[model samples]
Target chain A: MKPIIEISGISKRFRISHELQPYLNIRDRVSQIFSGKKATSTEEFWALKDITFSVEAGESIGIIGKNGAGKSTLLKILSKITPPSSGKIISRGRIASLLEVGTGFHPELTGRENIFLNGSILGMRKNEIQGKFDEIVDFSGVEKFLDTPLKHYSSGMQLRLAFAVAAFLEPEILIIDEVLAVGDAEFQKKCMGKMDEVSKSGRTILFVSHNMGAVSNLCSKAVLLRDGKIAMIDNSSKVVEQYLHDSVQMSGKRRKTISALDKSFTLQLPYWVNNAGEEIPSYSFGSDYKLRFDFEFHRELTFLNIGIAVMNKDGSRIFTSHSVDDKSFQSFSTYNGKMTFDAHLNIPDLAPGYYQVLFGVADEHTHDYVNASSEVEVILDIAETHKIKDGANGILWHTGQWKKVG
Target chain B: MEYEIKPAGRFSLNLSELWEYRELIFFFTWRDIKVKYKQTFFGAAWAVIQPLLLMVVFTVFFARNFTIESGNIPYPVFVFSGLLLWNVFANGLSNAGNSMVANANIIKKIYFPRLIIPISSILSAMVDFLISIIVYFCVLFFYGLQSTIPSILLMLPLSLLITLCTTLGAGSFLAALNVKYRDFRYVIPFLIQVLMFMTPIIYPVSTPDMEWVRTLLLLNPMTGAIDLIRSAVMQVPVNQTAVAMASVSSLLWLIIGISYFRRTEYYFADLA
Candidate 1:
């Protein structure tokens, strides 16, 4: 079978201006034209270089990359939003791109009118929108505000409405960017399910996202981009693993000593470990864990606070634990000698996801914090074991048992 | 198979592709019209009020102070006729010129005939022009003037066609140029102001005594269309030479505008 879309050696170059200002006024431009002064200086940036790919009909391909790795640029080129600087692309069948949720929604227009407007903007015919209008509204769940102007709806409601309109587009080939990064977790799951149905319907899909789990679940193949070039392309799971391994290597060794701070205090750590004192890169849910830190005090200190913060992958702090909070360790003082301290934490029954640990030391009295170069960052991957059921929600699970009280 | 996209040549109008996206053009025009009146208190009434009030100002100031010729018609009716066509051209030109930059978000995300933007803006402006024409007819009715109703009916549509063509020509040029130069943003309003004086909106085409000045005004494409409208509606004397010249010039501007627009359209997404 022939490929649905073929991209051959496509590259794009953007002219980067080094001037002090982004744009010049008409007066300056006119004077420059009269004086015959050319532009001061500029450099050429190759956003994509020799990116070649092909997609068979009914194939779901994921384009994974770090920011500025030309993922969005490639999608734009495929969508024909911009012309490539070099090479060619041949595509069959109708193609639709949902680069953003609400590309042309008007605030003054009511939700019903905006549904039709946004539907047409995404290349839907008027009758097609009318035919599916009820389904779209039902999916968006904005029935009460359907007649209200879009400006009155909250942003989340507006996004759902926009996505609802786009969700009904039945093009042969779909190009999607990181538009799923909006809304709440449940809405994201709905969007992912919609994408799953789209891919399963024997239509070609090209998805670009940073969500490794979503990509692995919905895409059969994945392409990793690094430095504007194709770094790897293979099965989704293998590609995701390779991408993560490359990232872990890029983050350097997990353990290091901090001597650049005030020499009076030296700090060291072995990052993350389990109850058995063995270093761990991952742990099962509901396990006991410890983050060990070694501190050497060259001089006696009045008061010091060591804190550990757990954050999700998006860098939102989940919780913070401090040594000063412990009743037994509150009045404990360190002498002019080395000592090992560990913060024992029970990994809350978290929904299977990635988390990071941030360690810091502060002077409790003066409110001064240590400016250490070797700040420790440990990534903890929590996997769901056979012990938990599938109906769990949110980041944390309460330890209390549930009962059929009714 | 390979689909290549180089910089399009000067002649690539791709009219068939535009024809395929005709429904999108309709939607865009509808969207502009809906959004234009969505938030306003007076809504579509502003369309009639704008030109009607302008006619009043021009009649009181120019017709009274300068004793402008109305060619056997009342001053208010004569000037209102001229203002009707002028409003369409002026509004269409400005709206079409700014449509591309204003819709940059959609342009950056999707691919469609870029010409649809300027065309839809012109169509929306036509809606306003149609509303204002009703007021012009009422002004004639108030003046108790006997209009050549059949001729008016026949010539109004023709004159509007000429106006639409001229606007598309100039507006498309400005739209494409505004994407790259951006100076056209300022230049358009200034040019429209100067053009109103040159197009005989408040004065007759033959008001100037000098033969050369009359010929100069006839060089403006709007001159012939406005002359055609006044002659057909108010039964004014027609200048065949000026009308012929104006018709030719309007078509020429249309060709120039579309050709320039087509040449620069491919770069619009990048520049915008």
Candidate 2:
């Protein structure tokens, strides 16, 4: 079969201002136009220096990268969300994307109204969407609240319905950004299943996500991006394995930054590893496991309270736990000493989830806080039968039992 | 079939293909409407309210208090007729202005005709125009004015053409400016504010006796539209020469606008 899309020698560069170049107000512009002197100096940033790759029909290609690595930019280019500078991109099919969940949705519109709205945005005909309406709503499980204004629904519900509408619409090619990070695991799994089905049905898919495990499981091929270039593109496993390597390496870069708004020293994690040298697993809600973080301090630090906030996929504070009041690490007077902190709590009452935990170190005396090492993502693949929470970020697992005092 | 869509350079707009994408146009239009009226308590009736209320204001200010001219017609009917024509054109132009930037999410994440956004925005305003026109006729009847069939025939298509030209020209100019200098987003609304009063929506074209003012105002394409509309409502014999001159100028603007827009369309998705 002829390749449905062909991209070769594609390059993109964005001009960045060293400083914000204020647009001349009408008066200033009039003067400048008349005077003809250069009013400002301009700088450039190569968002995508030189990119070259291709994908065949029915292939689910995952794009992975660090922030500003041009993963989203490449996806945007592929999806025709924007134009590429100084390069040629040749595509020969219809494409759909959920760049941001619920983008085309109006908060005042109900679920049913938004479905039609979103379907059309994806290029599906009204009749075509009308025919598939039931399946989309049923899949989203928003049928009960279909008539309610979407603003009343939880953010997760809005994401679920938006994804449903985009996924169900029949497009020859599909592009999806990190939108899958929204909603719970069961819903994400359902979304992945739908994407997989679409790929198998001979549609081309380009996916950009930070979720390495999802990329490995759902995509046939993957591209790892770094510094706005294609660092690696191969079979999903190889790409993900390299991605995992890069993620692990990042934690080791050992950068220093002061947390703003307080005199807290935060160590940026360049890479992370478990005791076995295995990258930390992707996490979901209520996962049964333990995580450990090791950090070093320059100044003689003492009397510190440590708290780790496990942020779910949405950057929410899923939960925070701390070391006890009298807790003291194996102290050291010198620079080259390691303090290992262990968290052994069974994550409970979380929606089927994926999470990244941020570890913070603070001076208990002056309340000086520092961001320390963080665990790489850990995934908990729970079965759908554990669907207990109804569209909420159920993070609390209350262990207290009630006694019949009456 | 194998497809590798890396850069969005290969998009080609086949008109026949856009026919297939008509549902998309309809959906985008509906989305615009929902977004506009969603939080408002008045709902779809608000579409009627804008031009109607403006008509009331125009009637009280210019038509009643000031001696603005409409050929052989009461001031209320004249100003409302002009409002009907100008309101639709302004709405279309405004939609075209912001359409590219507003759909940045969709444009960045998928591949469709980039032209579709502005076109759909203009299409959506057609619904509002239809809604308000119903009110236009009611006011017409209250004034005991009758629109001749021939006049209506000539004016309707002429007004649409004028709208097409002015919206395409001004919207394309604004869309391009919105990219490099996003300040145009603010500038556009203010420009429209000055534009509304400048057009004959509130006041009819100055009488031929004040030919200089008419000549200067005729530079605005909507001026021609308002004239065609007045001729439609009052059954006054239109100045064929002036109407013809306006039509020629509108077509010229249409060509220039589309050309500029096509030249700049390639950069929109990138900067927007």
Candidate 3:
């Protein structure tokens, strides 16, 4: 089978001007023209360099990259919103891109009118929109406010309406950006389900996202981009693992030490330690992890509290732990000397992914907070030898046993 | 199902591609017309109010002060006739000139025939012109002016066609230029202001004292459409030479405007 879209050696270059002003007035332009001054003070920056890729029919390809990795640029070039500075792209079948929701929606227009307006903007014919208008309104659940102007609808409602229009668009190839980042969790799930249905119907999809979980779930193949070039192209899981590994290394060391200027105290951490008190970058799933902190104080300290927070890659806090939360450590005061503090946290059966630990110290009475100089990354790798099947489904592994009562 | 986009060169008019997107053009024009009066208190009345009010002001000031000849026609009707066409040209030109910048969001996100923006703007202006013509007929009735039914029917649409063509020409030129150098925004309204006086909207083209000035006015593309309209609708004698000159110039402006617009439209998404 032939590929539906083929891109070869595509590159985009934008000229960066050093001048303070982004735009010139008519007077300055006229004077410059008369004076014959050349405007050559520009630096060329390539947003994409020789990116080559192709997608077969009915394939869903996920493009994973950090900001400025040319993901959006590649999508824009494919959508024909902007021309590439060099290279060629050959595409078959109708193409529609949803870089943003509500691209042409008018604030003053009623929800009903905006549906048609946005539908046509996405290349839907009038009859096609009319045919599925009721389905769209039903999916959006904005039936009560259909006649009201879009400005009166809440942002969530507006987003649902916009998504409905794009969802109903039956193009052969659909290009989507990070539009799923909006709305609540339930709505995101619904959007993901809708995209899954579309892909199941044998449509070509090019999805760009920062959410590794969504990309892994929806895409069979993934392309990782770094520094405007293809870093790796492989199965979704392997690409995501490589991307996570590369990101961890890019941040350099995980352990750090900080000494107070007044010599009041010094905090040091050797590394992230497992339950066995051994340094490790990764831990087996469903195991307790420990972090040991050594502190030295020249002056006596009172009412010192230690805190730790575990966060996911997207900076969402998984949970927080503090010494104050424990009954024995409350109201504890330390003398002027060396002391060791240890935090033991049981890792919930978390899905196999990277997590980070944040440490901070504070006075309970004064509420004066001191941040840790560095954070540690905890990689919860699925145990290779254990072979626990179907356990690592969601963020937490709920251990509810199933019984064949019938 | 298949499309190719390459860097645009000197002149390429994708007329077939434009035709394929005819529905979008219709939607854009309809949206503009609907949104124009959507929340307004006066609704469509504002369309007629503009040219009607301008005619009253010009008739009060110019007819009262100067001994202007209107070919034995009433000054109010004469000026209104001229204002009718002028309103279309001026409104259409200004609307089309700013349409690209106004629809910058859509232009940046979607790929369509960029010419649709300016064309739809002109189409909306034509709607306003059509509304104002009804008032033109009432004014003709009030003044008790008699014109040959056949000639009025024939000349009305022809004059409107010429005005529409001229507006499209100048409007697209300014629209394309405005995307790069927004100075055209300030320049358009001022140009229209000076052009109103130059095109014999308030004064007759054939001023008895200044043959040289009359000949110069004849060179203006609008002078021909105005003279043709006056001759056909008001039964004024036609200036054959002026009509020929105006027709030729208007066509020339149309050709040049479209060619220039087609050449530069590809870069609008980047520059705008």
Tens-digit lDDT track of model 2 for A138-164? 888888999999889987788888888
- Summarize candidate 3's per-residue lDDT along B15-47 as a digit string, tens digits: 898988888888888889988998899999998
- Model 1 chain B lDDT-worst window of ten: B1-10
Point out where model 1 deviates above 4 Å: A20-39, A252-406, B1-11
Q: How high is the CA lDDT of each candidate model?
A: 0.81, 0.69, 0.80
Model 3: per-residue lDDT, tens digit, A1-406?
A: 6688888888888887776456888888888899987544778999899889888889999998766789988898888888888888889879999999888899888999999988988899999999999999999999999999898999899999999999998999999998886776689889999999999999999999866667777888889998789999998878877876765554425444566544578877424566677766665666676767778877888767777776655445688888788886546556468887777766666666666556667765634244342222333343433655775566565556889998
Model 3 clash pairs? Answer: none
lDDT of 1 by residue, B177-232 (tens): 99998899999999999999888888888788999888899888788888887887
Best by lDDT: 1
Residue A363 CA error for candidate 3 (Å)?
A: 24
Which 10 residues in a row give candidate 1 chain A its minimum summed lDDT? A366-375
Instruction: Pick the winner on DockQ between candidates 2 and 3.
Output: 3
Off by over 4 Å in 3: A20-40, A251-406, B146-150, B208-215
Worst 10 residues of 2 chain B by lDDT: B1-10
Candidate 2 DockQ, CA atoms: 0.39
Worst 10 residues of 3 chain B by lDDT: B1-10
The Cα error of candidate 1 at residue A209, in Å, is 0.3
